[model samples]
Target chain A: MATELPSNIKSSDVLTDQTSSKWLPPGLALQKVDERIMTLNVGPQHPGSGHMRLIVQIDGDYIVACDPDPGYVHRGEEKMAEYRNYITNIPHLERPVIHDSCNVLYPYVLGVEELLGIEVPERAKYVRVIASELNRCIYIMYWLAIYGIFLGHSTMFMWPAGDRELLIDLMEKMTGARVTHAHFVPGGVRNDLPPNFEEVCLRQVAYFEKRIKEYAAVFYDNPILIARTQDTGVLSRQDAIRLGTTGSVLRASGVDYDLRQKEPYDVYEELDIHSNVMKEGDSYARSKIPWLDMMESCNIIRQALQKMPKSGSVRVKLKPNPKGKGLNTVYKRVESGRGSLGCYIVSDGKPEPYRVKLSVPSFRNLIALPYLLKGEKLGNMPSVYWSLNYWPVEADR
Target chain B: MIGTATGIIRALNSGIKHLAIKRFTLRYPEEKLKFVGDGYQFDPSTGVGIAGLKGRHLLFHDHCTGCQLCSIACEGVAEAIAMVKVPEEHKQNKKAIMPQIDYGKCVFCGLCVDACPFYALYMTNDYELSSFSKEGLIYTPAQLQVKPYVAQDSEIIITSRGATHG
Candidate 1:
């Protein structure tokens, strides 16, 4: 049986009532609340929210509250890592952020090397830095493409996507695959750079930098984009720090902390690393920081290529079925594309790790979503939500 | 007002400038992209790998000793490699067993190649492995031994205007 709408209830009111007896079976109805307040599910399937749901409660045009529901794309990556040995875990561990696979694996590799007591070669260190920087650009470009599409800018999407291929091509030459580059192993990289790789890398990186610079004219400088995102969903510095936001979210909030600069893992200490910090904690600044970081990545790749040893072994060969020491634990963190990605490993003299935990930036940055989207307009949802640089798979993993 | 107008104009100008640049895509069926080398190969002595595309795998019948290292390596990751009995007789491979890779499940991680100490298994640039049936996806020892033909000839060429596959 169907029920007619009451005289007082508007057409939009039908959607707001989740416990209406009209749709549900009899006796399933719950108590009703204020009529003006509406609940919006911004997708486990919506274009704006990719593979995650945002339970948004709105009053008129303003958002009263927004709850980010991650784990729709969760694959139990941490549990899977415990079953497999260290070497076998490489393929699946990088699955969370495959576009930036090198950085995602960086922390895990460092932690494993610590447990195994293997000293990485100097050439390998430089090579790892270069790969990490290249992967960072690849990831930022992919993120920028999605961010552009979220803000209804198709041209912004196309330019970053097409320009991204330049780095992807270089990556395909370095590592076999374009995206899921299981290139980083425990000791060092799986393979050394191909012959003539330096010249090709230098040429492509120069062009890629030039290409990304042009994005400012189209995306960041566009009047429409500036107006839509400039002051909306501002995360204050104090709130950001208190909430413990990482990566670009923290950097955009005027907290000048970069793991590569502060911690200096691998060869970051030797290189001139410049952290991009912005005073404006709005969506615009949060989105622009990654772009600036990409420019910095280009410089890093050039420097690493120059300083890399002329000829040496990239990987320290280990015995088959390598096992970590008994009663050992190591924690390692690196600056991934999204933010500071940390890996915690516990070994008990077994081929398989006793415990593996990945503290991903996407999940850490997600804590700021409800805080940022609290009083933002419904129209500003996409820009504000995406500018936090939250990747759903990484967050859920 | 002037700043807004100028910003709009600059965005428009940049978009228009890209119109003159060449399209950055390959006509896939007619033109295939070229690869750097024969395939991804590892030297057990050097303990380092050579860079190449990780497509379908190539198994050397003469080199493989039925050690089952590739199968063991792939068990945790994809379970794509399975040891199968071979009819062909070889002096090195006394057990007459070799790896049969199911392409449908293979993640192309190249761990199997790295695991093979005898230089028996290596990945080739032949990535195109589509078939009508799932059964056709699994390549047997005999099938893996044969080198598939690849027609790839295109590579990315950067110019003053832009980069394009040429």
Candidate 2:
């Protein structure tokens, strides 16, 4: 919200009051400021804002009020899903968060499979687990890269960007696409893993784990970064749950609830997953949790590879234009890059869905932005805001 | 002050170490990463299509029966494939129609290839399909028939020091 200035003013008065007043339209006159609070529009075009605006009012470098403005990149993905068939919606549904396509499509596939009443093969479950883990790391690395850039750490940005390619390369061999792999479909995945995939996957993922460990020395353990973000924008454990925060943000606040661990999906129950939690409830804790999760994902991938069936079908054959049995609604959720991503589909016994609703984690985590941003310093904005792992595109979708 | 200095030095040291490491970037146009298979193919016996990068479409004029399954599949996702009247007539294609794909609108999802049961359509690793004009992007049936020649030999080589694309 913009403040209204006076309607009329003299040129001499305007020059005298120029220090306190901002430039207005030619016809509008300057108004006398009652309080010294200045409003700053961190617009959508800014790199740090990520297609969302933050209306912040500052009083001497301290943020007095912060209002997050999302929905700049909304494409109405839910409405579009109603027109498309179950099989065709994969490519478009994964577009909101392309790097984490597997996780985004995970819930949709699960819901569709339930509606169809078909069981996924044992091999398919392990393959799905591997893909989901790889996608999780890919999404985290991209988020970390952006977080690094926002904090003015250029080396942090480059390292994650470079290291992300290893996972991306692995994903490409499995799913055919680099980022937007519409591999996960109803009943099962699109195809089986490529020949000689296990060796390549194991080797690359091992190297990637070693590469990620190098980041702690230069980034997470860096004293300057620690001092800047350690105690700033502290979110208490109760506040996090009351505000309905999920994923890393919630974990940082000492809640050890991971969807993969709590409500195990696919082959996640078979594999051992350690939930990383921190009690600090600060930006540093939020930033560190994802790295720990990435390490856990690496272990899960190795375990899945070992337990996966050597020779079996990865997909269950479904009839062309598959439809639900009855007029019913099904809701399925999976742990995505940001947090819990839920997909609710209302089927009316037709090829097309009657209604589709996506409960995205980005939008859910955005509730904590204004709460955390208020009374914080201006310089801490980027570190605190990005540490929440808010992807505006996913939120807006 | 000492802690800050050590942090800065560690960051600088990490950066300098990476400078000695080989670049992971693949110099495009001159080098391309080689794919595993020829293209993404579907078998009628099997429900799933083989895994490969969904790049450019390869159409077989003989096997295509002008059934319009690929066009139907692309309708909801990306309406990039449209059936057009071809000059050459085939016995299988009685309508003398073939699918012409608009690369500009195509998401390269490979659903179209899976929709074709006759093994008439597949995707090749010809991702370098940049065009200057809109008209140039719409590949005709005849154009789609021509197999692209790609010289890709690069692969990721990981050593004790670091990984490099070579």
TM-score of chain B of each: 0.97, 0.93
Worst 10 residues of 2 chain A by lDDT: A25-34
lDDT of model 1, residue A132: 93
lDDT of each: 0.91, 0.89
DockQ of candidate 1 is: 0.84
Residue B126 miss distance in model 1 (angstroms): 0.4
Clashing pairs in 2: none
Clash pairs, model 1 backbone: none
Winner by lDDT: 1
Candidate 1 reference-contact recovery: 0.87
* Deviating ranges (above 4 Å) for candidate 1: A1-32, A46-50
lDDT of 2 by residue, A1-397 (tens): 2335454545555443445456454324444554689988988765543488888889999998888888788898988998899989989999889888999999989998998898999999999999999999999999899889988988888889999999999998888888899999887888889999999999999999999999988999898789999999999999999999999999999999999989988888888889999999999999999999999999999999999999888888889899898898999999987889999988999999898888999888889998998899999999999999888888888
